[model samples]
Target: MQKINVLGALLVLGLMVQCKGDKKSVNKVESNAPITEVTESVVDTTPIIIEKPENIKVPDGMVWIPGGEFIQGAVPQDKMAMDHEKPAHKVKVDGFFMDVTEVTNAQFAKFVKETGYVTVAERAIDWEEMKTQVPEGTPKPHDSILQPGSLTFKKTKTSVPNLYDFSQWWNWTIGANWKQPNGPGSTIKGKDNEPVVQVAYEDALAYCEWAGRRLPTEAEWERAARGNKSESIYFWGDDDSILSQKANTWEGEFPVTNNKADGYEQRAKVKSYPPNDFGLYDMAGNVWEWTSDWYNTNYYNELGAVNGPVVNPQGASTPYNPNMPYAKEKVMRGGSFLCNASYCASYRISSRMASSLDSSLEHLGFRTVATVDMLTAN
Candidate 1:
């Protein structure tokens, strides 16, 4: 067995990457008016009406976000917002389409049957790759040998913590993958509707390629999540309180005891809850969606005062916050069923998180995205 640092491989790729075409165009607007005040009673007889296109139906179980500019990041007043979400900036995204729900067990199984695609957890690790990740002089013990790894929840109180330590609910169990999600003895015999878990970043990429789509970049994901709303904390607004009827998140004493108020103690069906303003479901909770950007805490600080960054195809190479651990993990957006008010509140649309490249967890899943081509006059 060999040890290879996944971050090193990514850094190598980042160096050779070429600048791609700019996705957002810069525009300037001018207005001239004299300051004046009018009383509410001054209005005579005027009617206001708005219209929208009727043919804007997104693919079934999906939503079309007419991309534009929005303030991205945290508000100065939010005490709970992480520092990474600071220095709010404006971001403009082109029109694109996104999944209304995360990829479910049934969908993943179909892909497997059609392409015989084995998840990273199911495949044996290559010795050469392993050697590149692990540091020299580290003992290559038999227990540490490459094997299938995925997230698992310990139902027992003694085995799991009641707090936000992910290590409590997530474990790298050997022989755990899509088929054997709970280690060797478990099987996906009846969980066809559940979101597919135990998938690595590469596994997701493979699925995207097979489906003729790609993972959404962090910016694109955020835009889709915001819908047509202004710069707000959540996809809906600045509210942080959990609405029992809206999402599928934890609703009791953390890991020790779940009240199941949301009608679920574990993963729920993808479309179990109400959809967002754009008719997208499970965007706030259920499972975190993967993004193409690397995790960086201060990336927003570089964006302009309007909260928009320069139109660049790729994200920063280094993590934004130097005080934090070196970011070897890719970004995961949208929270999961495990997210609760007490722990891991990241299920919000703007919340961000990351995981090791080779790591897999039952609580993590992903959705697909594609560019929306506008019909042009020939």
Candidate 2:
């Protein structure tokens, strides 16, 4: 009976955008602030840092994350910790090169140009392939609803009365691809430096293949996002109040009002906020980055029983969410701009989120990592 996909369920955190209801309308931003310049490109177009250590070559736009042992989950007393992020367990990760920032429009543009990759959002939906994902007997979506497009957040005309009913804000916009993030009229020009959104897991993987990189495993992402620290509620520190302009999260009321106190209504340019100790930008906000891990709510609990740190822990072999056990979902790290304390506070360093691999949205993007083997192979 639901018109929206699982994306609508995952995004219904507090006052965050929800599925579009009968009240269809778009709220416009009235701000007249000048668009800020894009930050320096993460890709080092010049060949310079070749004299580094054997294990840490520091790829052009990437940084050397000297991986080591660290706690991978959340501890009790961290009131905000979710069930999936509990039972803090020790994990050991190998060193690798990580993109310093989320893959920007310019970077993905090059990949598209080189390989002519058609993103999942650009391809028409296949009902035969999709019906298997839903419970048997669920009605098939109308042919018109199967068009190529992606989910997008539209501000509510009024304050959201029910956070659980997200249909007031989330809309499956037709023609909403990465090239046109907002909808048919939106374009990526002038925002070339911003993180590319509306990317499904396959789209991100295609870009990785073209660039000779791979998506980071969930362990590597958490370890790197923590900046090699032992424990902290957030990437920056334990403090929750420090998430204002430091990260591009919602600063005002939920779907109704976005104060744009951080100088952004939607996604912001990479490096708009200060990097963590690891020198990684946008680790906390801007857009949710995809990870190469299957989603399993019980995965952490399984690791907790281990006697020692789980070395280079790959996620569960199969995806499983009790709420939607049949759906093929992948782990997503780092919260997006839509995250706010008023609704969803997933910006916590230890928080976790997952979405169907086929789902794409305006608030989602990804970065890639390269291991020693991958780098040498290239």
Best by lDDT: 2
Model 2 lDDT per residue over 201-280, tens place? 88888898888899999989998899845667788777777788578998899988889888898999999999988899
Please provide TM-scores, in order, for all candidate models, with all chains considered together.
Answer: 0.76, 0.85
Query: Candidate 2: which pairs clash?
Result: 14-343, 15-343, 18-166, 18-170, 19-166, 19-167, 42-61
Q: Report how far residue 77 has shifted in candidate 2, in Å.
A: 4.1
lDDT of candidate 1 over 1-378, digit per residue (tens): 322323322232232122223211100111221111212112223321122235544556556666565666665555556645655665556666677788888888989999998777766656556544445443444536445455576654663432423444545566777777677898778888778887778889989887767788877787777776665666667665545577778877766677888898778887888777777888888877788876654454444332223332245454332222333567888888878766557756667776666666777789987664431211
Candidate 2 has its poorest 10 consecutive residues by lDDT at 21-30
Give candidate 2's error at residue 333 in angstroms.
0.7
**Model 2 local distance difference test score:** 0.76
RMSD of each: 11.6, 11.0
